[model samples]
Target: MSDRPATSRVLVIVPAWNEEESIGDTVTEIRACVPWADLLVVDDGSSDGTRGAAENAGATVCQLPFNLGVGGAMRTGYRYALRHGYDVAVQIDADGQHDPRSLLSLLEPLGESDIVIGARFASKDDPYKVRGPRRWAMVLLATVLSRMAGTRLTDVTSGYRVCNRRAITVFAAHYPAEYLGDTVESLVIANRAGCTVTQVPVTMRPRAGGRASHSPVRAAIYLFRAFVALSLALVRKWPAQFEDPVAP
Candidate 1:
């Protein structure tokens, strides 16, 4: 556990879309792992019973009018965190691939940095591996982001992460609003905004239910789009701080 004050509010933000089978268990596991933290599930217009399942599992539900992908859903959570005056916020996948037990490890570094990514590839002992084209793509992204941020980043696509108040404020204001935009682009934005970003090794588990949103065809399309986005991010100038307060 972090040495931060007990009153330091921590929120676990789970973005779910048709994850009815696993969202409930994901919420329950998070409660068990971090009993003091509040839970918020961003239901991204899930057609199934995801919102009800999350509510039953003891999480506050934030329903979107339509599916806005992970980036939009997480941005909603960030806005919520800022509005609620939370000291820290963590994004956990609703698919149960992210281990709740690793929350403490991710939070331990938040005292020194604005963001702490729970990196799957950061540990050599971890058996999880990204194979084929995806593996190559991650390597390329990691290399680019590492150079841009002036820090080593092993997992550019990992969603398991913790962010402090400053990070939440920045993200709430200008988070990327496109598909897969939450991963690499968010890091670039954070670094450009003068937020210290770092990573900690964490083991990832197989998804508890449902299939990944990415297929081979989708992955190819994402690669081209990601390249274009990353290039733009590198040249774009950003403000030193976020001035606009997000309205609840």
Candidate 2:
């Protein structure tokens, strides 16, 4: 993160799936931390009362008809932001892992960066550490992506980040919903499409409630998928027309 810029019309998108217990609290906390931004909870086909919880907590809810994972929900949120004339978009988890207070720090680099990632490992005294195969995969991804981006990125898989209009436009048009596409491949697409990416240190909290999508036992699987996503991203490029989503 680098230079600061004037910001207007910010939307905080939270993708929730059966996270009724934490969605309400997450919304309230965000409203407390960043009261100026609009909140959108993309309920990813939750069978529970996630929609009601979010609505009661004072968020606009967009309930997906079925579960499409985090990537799909985030793509929907990006499109919603682009259509609603919002100039900035930020993705925060409904499980309470992403701290809302650090949002301002993440936005600090907006003028200098098109996409800013809230990297957990880059922060001081950060407790959210991944180990085993997952940690190895993260290191590899960060190393490869850092070389590609010409910057040091400690956490390439982080979802806690902010995007300006340029980044939003690119994502709205070509964001993928594949396994690791949202965080990994999407960055590749953005870089290929000529968007600048950077990251800032952020302290993430433990999940307040809800189930985790990945477990320790699944670290090996995640490692494999991460490589696959990276491979596809390296070989493929965003189409030429997506260079500018706002042009008529």
* Local distance difference test, each candidate: 0.88, 0.90
> What TM-scores do the predictions have?
0.93, 0.94
Clash number for candidate 2: 1
| Pairs of residues clashing in candidate 1 | none
Compose the digit string of candidate 1's lDDT tens values, residues 91-172.
9999999998888878878789999999988877999976766677788889999887788999988999999999999999
Summarize candidate 2's per-residue lDDT along 1-248 as a digit string, tens digits: 22223657899999999999999999999998888889999999999999999999999999999999999999999999998899899999999989888888888798899999999899668888789999999999999999888899999999898999998999988888998889999888888878899999998888899667678769999898888989998998567557445455
lDDT of 1: 0.88
Give model 2's TM-score versus the native structure. 0.94
